[model samples]
Target: MTTARIYQRPKNAMQSGRARTDNWVLEFAPSEAKKADPLTGWAGSGDTRDQVRIGFPTQEAAVAYAEREGLAFTLFPAPERKLKLQAYADNFR
Candidate 1:
């Protein structure tokens, strides 16, 4: 049985723009723990499903797809957005 997680895309902290944050993403849970490469010291695993991510416009759509595929999934609702109102001059203080 494949397990997956459905959640909304988070806003990137590197940029102010919130584009594409409304979409939901489905990611497969890693089946096995990653092993370090002896030579390059890179972390990797044989489970490739973790590398795939599917995006949907709405949460319901994402859930539907998961159910249709018979995949067990956990849905995590997006956290509420809080805006901090600040003035340009407040930066000096």
Candidate 2:
């Protein structure tokens, strides 16, 4: 049986905008550990399912898809965002 992980997308550290972060993502867990190629030295795995990612508007939608596909899944809770409230003048202090 294939196992999957469902979680909300995290905000990118390099960007200030929250685009696409609101969607929940379903990703298949790697069946095998990645191995380094002897000649190219690039790390990769034969599990092509690792490259599949499906996005849903809501968490329930993501879970439903996994259940319908008979995939075992683990749902991860979204991380809480903490705002560092600071005034512009505080930067000078």
Candidate 3:
């Protein structure tokens, strides 16, 4: 069984507004092992599915999709952001 991780988007450090936390993201753990090429020593990851990113509007929606797909998964809660209310006049100061 392939395992997947479900987590809400974290707010950006610079801007605590709802910029990036609009959706929940589902990421699959690497089903295949990655190896380095012997000739070039370049690393190549296997499976294009591992690179695919799916977004859900809500955390519950993300969980439902994983469950419906029969994917074993874990859910991580997003951190609460404390946004400071600043006025445009403060920028001059």
Top-lDDT structure, candidate number = 1
Candidate 1: tens digits of C-alpha lDDT, residues 1-93: 999999998899999999999999999999999999999999999999989999999999999999999999999999999989999999999
Worst 10 residues of 1 by lDDT: 42-51
Clashing pairs in model 3, backbone N/Cα/C closer than 3 A: none
lDDT of 2 by residue, 1-93 (tens): 999999999999999999999999999999999999999999998999999999999999999999999999999999999999999999899
What count of clashes does model 2 give? 0
The backbone clash count of each candidate, in order, is 0, 0, 0
The candidate, 1 or 3, that scores higher on TM-score is: 1
Quote the lDDT for 88 in model 3: 100
Model 2 CA deviation exceeding 4 Å by range: none
- TM-score to true structure, per model: 0.88, 0.89, 0.74
Q: Candidate 3: lDDT of 42?
A: 89
Instruction: Kindly state the number of residue pairs that clash in model 1.
Output: 0
Candidate 3 backbone overlaps, count: 0
The residue pairs found clashing in candidate 1 are: none
**What's the distance in Å from true for residue 55, model 1?**
0.6
